[model samples]
Target chain A: MAIEVRIPTILRTYTDGAKAVEGNGATLDALFADLDARHPGIRARLVDAGELRRFVNVYLNDEDVRFLDGINTALGDNDNVTILPAVAGGSV
Target chain B: MKYDTPLEAVGNTPLVGLPRLSAAIPGNLGSDGHGAGAVRLWAKLEDRNPTGSIKDRPALHMIERAEADGRLTPGCTILEPTSGNTGISLAMAAKLKGYRMVCVMPENTSEERRELLRMWGAEVIPSPAAGGSNTAVRVAKELAAEHPDWVMLYQYGNPDNAGAHYATTGPEILADLPTVTHFVAGLGTTGTLMGVGRYLREKVPGVTIVAAEPRYDDLVYGLRNLDEGFVPELYDASVLSTRFSVGSADAVRGTRDLLQQEGIFAGVSTGAILHAALGVGRKAAKAGERADIVFVVADGGWKYLSTGIYTAATTEDAVEALQGQLWA
Candidate 1:
């Protein structure tokens, strides 16, 4: 299954500055492993200690993955994954 | 409708049904042929508040709580970090309460927002656009440290912020629509989501709380390493069932859809909430489940009038015109 993952600007150095990249995995943990296989050391930035980094947010089709099973969230073909840094919100 | 003070009228906004928009969503044909128990959309018209925004509830509640506890006294200066609405609400309340108000806002916010703050006699300090509200919060904290006399009502961490929503907004929605299955709102300081989400979760069985977070351009995260992004202290992920990051273009499109389809003119952040609400509505419809989705219209679009998003001929042109600027 192919899933397109959107990369944040800070992590672009791993994807050669590509805004998005395609990888295959049934779950987020496996997807990151797949991404690291091709991108080299990118998984370490997103995951550590067998969990997602505190500052790194991974969303599957815009819905936060943390609520949906975290790294174990299921993935499917044509799923759009987005990675972003944790930022404070104040749209009041 | 009679109140001794404007602050007394901070909440109790009307909840109106969006029959047209709800009927527009595609659902299973087999569900109650008349569309009964299918799906419905309800909008909490928070723009009708005294300050024309939902933030008035928290701003007033926070200030009053402080005043009642003696943390805020006569001749005290109030401080906060806001995008616009909260500052404007606080400024108005402070002016009426005889307290000086100062706001640290992002430089990227609209000019109209600045004018509104100034109109209410609030001093505006513009933080760098690099990190948006994150920068504003940092700057506000620094300023508060320099002047120990200034009372920063720090919305992000203050429990009173969420308390306002829990005490008023949540009860109002439950009273107005007992059948509400989902609650959606913009995720900012996470006050609204936290307070209302907690209240509804306790009162309603199997209620879903959804968050629509604004996804800004890279400039909002400018030069910050991956570890630098900040999360609100009040944010409890357990309070939210799911969260969707809505980009500016989608936000604008959602705003236009509300205006065109439902005739509700709301701020860009509210647009993000509506977009997420509709997304959930679509999924529920596909599942042939009954749903009453209520989303907050945080404020009117007047503050963002200069953005030309509402009058633009097309959503693409509107979004293109919105580029490089923070809409939410």
Candidate 2:
């Protein structure tokens, strides 16, 4: 399956300013590996060692992967993977 | 009642202790006035403000700073992009000070926020919700371009937000608890964390700063995070000895647990902080160490009561069934 990985605005610098890129995999883990292969250093930014970085979120079709199968969540063709960064602003 | 206002009530909020919760997590240091094992969890209750949120701190500061520098006039409209609190604060403050306030907000904001702003008499412009606050910022920028006389506070990128907490909230916490070992707070806007964290880190070199982030995928109010970007401009992450993130459901459960068990009705983000504090507490207990962790509960739970967070229908069968459906 080919899924579209949406990169956050901050991480675009690592992906040649592209907001999104294509990856091939059947599950979330495979998709991430595919992304890391294409854009080196991307995996380090998204996953830490063998775990998903606490700050990074992988949303498959807008649903949190944790609520699904976590890193093993199966992906279908044309699935959208959104990488959203924390917006920590505002007073209080 | 015609009463004198102290610079429009920019600061000076009450700090209360969470005695019940403090007991559950032992070895936590108590404030100087309290007994040992009776650690104090002081909440900087911003909900008590005139606008019911802490954004009052920055909204007032931003307006006053602009006025002091001769950049704002009575007729000029105050503009900004916000999700909820900032706009509500600016609306009440600007209207009282004789300025027209216009706010650009994501269209998906809660109905309560929109009605509150309308009650305060501020003009609201809705931007696309799918684009999040980014769209609101773009809209604000476009409006400011068309209206040359408008002044936009731009809280997302504004230093004033963090500065407000630094100058006020930070000092207040220090005065209240000079021996605070750890400071925990949610990472939204990074203003509270950045400002308070900087001040505490400087005043108390050993003070540990921890960000209680929602588990990365928890997008209740559209707040999400990526690994590459951290809100650390005013925040020094090196000062933090540890960081803990809690799942949204875990946070919600924590809030409910605190309210029922400890009687502290704080918001979901506060629950995240509490859950993180408990994690820190458990770790300290295992090491047989004493550590005082102070968490900031930004607001009361009144705003989220409608969501039924505190009123979950957790029957025995329901609980078991929900647990049964977990993915292997």
Candidate 3:
């Protein structure tokens, strides 16, 4: 099984316009590293100095990684990862 | 149940149990497992407030605080950026206070919201729909800068926004349900989460505060660089135990479920909050731990009725109707 990472529209340039890409790793950091090997410079936009950027939100399944273990959060091959830009919430 | 004025009834909303929902979800045995105590889901019906939304609390509080501090005086012009509820709330309060109200809102919001604001005597300025409320906030800021006389009670940065919940919402929830184990609410201005989260932390030990945020579709983020993403200044990560982002489809499903199962008709954002509450409750139940979870219903379903979310044949059909609109 491979871990699927869904890319946001703004970050699709790293994946050659593909909406999602598959990679494998035991943890998110390793997964990002593995993804970077194929999709270069994608990790820098998501992470800043070993931490997630303030405006970037990453979710595994439906849960936020920051609440689990940040970059060290464990990843399973079947787990789906979603990356999104944090914008002003539309709860009107 | 009596108030001298409509504004005086902004809070003290009911905290009712969601028994049917709780029983349907498996593994909801409370810690002690005593007659519905095993698992409980409480709804804080902020929809019962004066302006038919929770924003009434913060809007009234911010305006009153400003009036006290000399920032807002009689007949002053008020400016704000809102997706819907906040503008309606401010417009209601502004009209009563003899103040002129102007709101910067995204062009994609519901028609009922615009009518509601106008009905309350507020002027509406439409911001581009690409960035959603973030664009509205930016436009409102520019307008404020141009007109120094206008009092922009910026909800995103205003302390009173959260303070209102701290003083009223938090205490009301605690008083109503002292055993509340989890508090869940939609993440908008972040005022509700920060204010109530802080107060709950101080009063209840080991209480969990969760924020359920909307996952805007690509159209909402259209052509915008990552640098342009907006996070409210009122947001402080430490106040929340965790956050979840719900997509539009799930929000619609949850909204329908709430009305169908519990007969509680609430907005789409309330569904997102309910989704998070149900998730945590399910987790606790699976672990054989008892919990009392409370979620906020930000507003009634009236404003969104025009979106066909209530009468659509399928969730997908309902979702399609709200596509690119600020239904979240």
DockQ of each: 0.72, 0.14, 0.73
Question: Model 2: per-residue lDDT, tens digit, B12-81?
Answer: 7777766666666656554445543634455667666777677788788888888888888878898988
Candidate 1 residues B1-328, lDDT tens each? 7999778888999998877678888762333443434788889999999989999999999999999999999999999999898999999999999999999999988999999999999999999998888889899999999999999999999999999999999999999999999999999899999999999999999999999998887777666677777889999998899999999888999899899988999888888888999999999998878888999999989988898999999999888777766676
User: Which scores better on lDDT, 1 or 2?
Assistant: 1
- The worst-scoring run of ten residues by lDDT in candidate 2 chain B lies at B319-328
What fnat does each of the candidate structures reach? 0.70, 0.23, 0.69
Name model 3 segments beyond 4 Å from true: A90-92, B29-37
| Candidate 2 stretches greater than 4 Å from native | A1-92, B1-3, B26-40, B215-243, B315-328
RMSD of each: 1.7, 9.0, 1.6
| Candidates' C-alpha lDDT | 0.90, 0.68, 0.90
State which docking tier applies to candidate 3. medium
Chain B TM-score per candidate, please. Answer: 0.97, 0.82, 0.97
lDDT of 3 by residue, B1-328 (tens): 7889988888999998888888877865433333354768999999999889999999999999999999998879999999989999999999988999999999999999999999999999999998888899999999999999999999999999999999999999999889889999999899999999999999999999999989867898776677668888898999999999898988998899999999999999998889889898888888878688999999999999999999999999998988998875
Q: Which interface RMSD values do the candidates have, in the order shown?
A: 1.3, 9.3, 1.3
